[model samples]
Target: MKHLTYFIIFFSSINLFGQVNYSGFIDKYPIELSADINTSGNSYGVYVYTAYDDPIVLEGNLQKGKLIFFEKNSKGNKSASMTFEKFNLDSESIEGIWKDLKNGKELKITLSKKNEIGDGIIQKTSIGDRYFRIVADDQNVSEIKIFQKKTDKLIQKLKVDCQFRGVHCISTGDYNFDGITDFSIFESSYAGPNTSSLYFLYNPKTKKYFESGFSGTSLEFDAKRKRIIETNQCCAGSSVTTAEYKVIKNKMILEKERCFKWSEKKQELIERKVSECR
Candidate 1:
């Protein structure tokens, strides 16, 4: 197992004159905008967000405090475009006129500095002598970092690129019977209605948290039994599988597995033992 650290700074400050970095909602629209202007280079990177779709990135140039950008859909066609005119950062509220090129509509746009925790959320937990922080963005967990509580020396950081809804983010508990707390984050599958999770178990001997090979959808950590029970629906409610695991020599070993399937004639669930482990 490997422990790695990754860092990404989502915010930037205005250094050069006429350059602005603003993140806020578009006035009267259900959309969010994060714009970065580089007056020195005459370039900008803008990100537009909506609830149902992923964030769209647009690149363009700025001239005389006016920023223009365009976005393309997944099919490589021009989906929409925006033009921000009179982008003034000196006012108490950053206001401008946003022109929608595709719809031929112009809107009043107001922007503000984004809150630190608005886009990304952070939580702290402990495992034995180590303290860890979990950071999550809108789409998925961005990173997991471990550090010493006393010295504040960072031990490791792992950058995760998993897509998950923001509702059920991450959890921490002692699941491996190592007297150290472990962490878990759910990763949803893109193709189907299934979700798999990632577990990081703490190693007391090495003073590091290693990624467990175990993965499942619904995970229940049994501290008393020192086991992890996972259940997932198979074949669109026709069958389901449940597996139990225990930590043995710093590894998750499957102890037992049972599957249940719908019996058409009997109108009941038929039980069968399964030997597969995931």
Candidate 2:
């Protein structure tokens, strides 16, 4: 009897150390799962959420087929040890056993596979009830598609010409305060220090993203102040010109202008205000 008990305990210890293969699962499946860790105290808390549901707060570590952790409530005061069992991953779904520690309630949870856009990095934003997915392939954005989350209907498709290597070159926000999300792409000149930017403004009347006539180098949008700023360098960076514009009636109206030039006598930069908006 003593030898049999030792063998049972040894087998259980081997099963407890099994780990979930996160990288292999994400690569083979078209799903995204985000885990946020908060290490405010000695015990680290984790919040797990899929693209479909709200985050579930749990203070636990995974061991084999068990999630050994504490479940935290919304108030952050109450916690109980929650052990999830039967955690299994297959080709189409992730099956697990979810248990509520406080009340000793258990439920089976299965996460099904969902389709994603392109293989590139996906940047998502919402305008009202509609959501837009922007997929970028390295330096170039190959596709931009807008769809309704409820019905999965493709509303609009836009092909952009701007190409930049960095992810910061593309952004989406309500630049014009029109209650619609707009997109901007910044493209840098390959041979020069100059940059060119393009804007796609969302038109509610037409229900589409229309290309605005506004184009500039070194373009930036001040979302908090609702202003557009542009800067241009001339004479090989010897002189710099800056302009501020406000969007009015789908037009960028210049509001202020300033210029900076290198002073040969002072061996420094000098600033001057321009009276003309251009």
Backbone clash count, each prediction separately:
2, 1
Overall lDDT per candidate, in order of appearance:
0.57, 0.52
Candidate 2 at 187: error in angstroms?
A: 3.4
Residue-level lDDT of model 2, residues 135-253, one tens digit each, is 55434666666665445577888777556332234467776767678876655452235567677898778878877888776677887888988877666555667789999998899
Q: Show model 2 residue runs off by greater than 4 Å.
A: 1-30, 33-121, 124-129, 135-138, 164-169, 189-194, 223-226, 234-236, 272-278
Q: Tens-digit lDDT track for model 1 on 189-228?
A: 5222345677877776786778887766667888888898
How do all models score by TM-score?
Answer: 0.48, 0.51
Winning candidate number (TM-score): 2
Model 1: residues >4 Å from true position, as ranges? 1-120, 124-138, 147-155, 189-194, 273-278
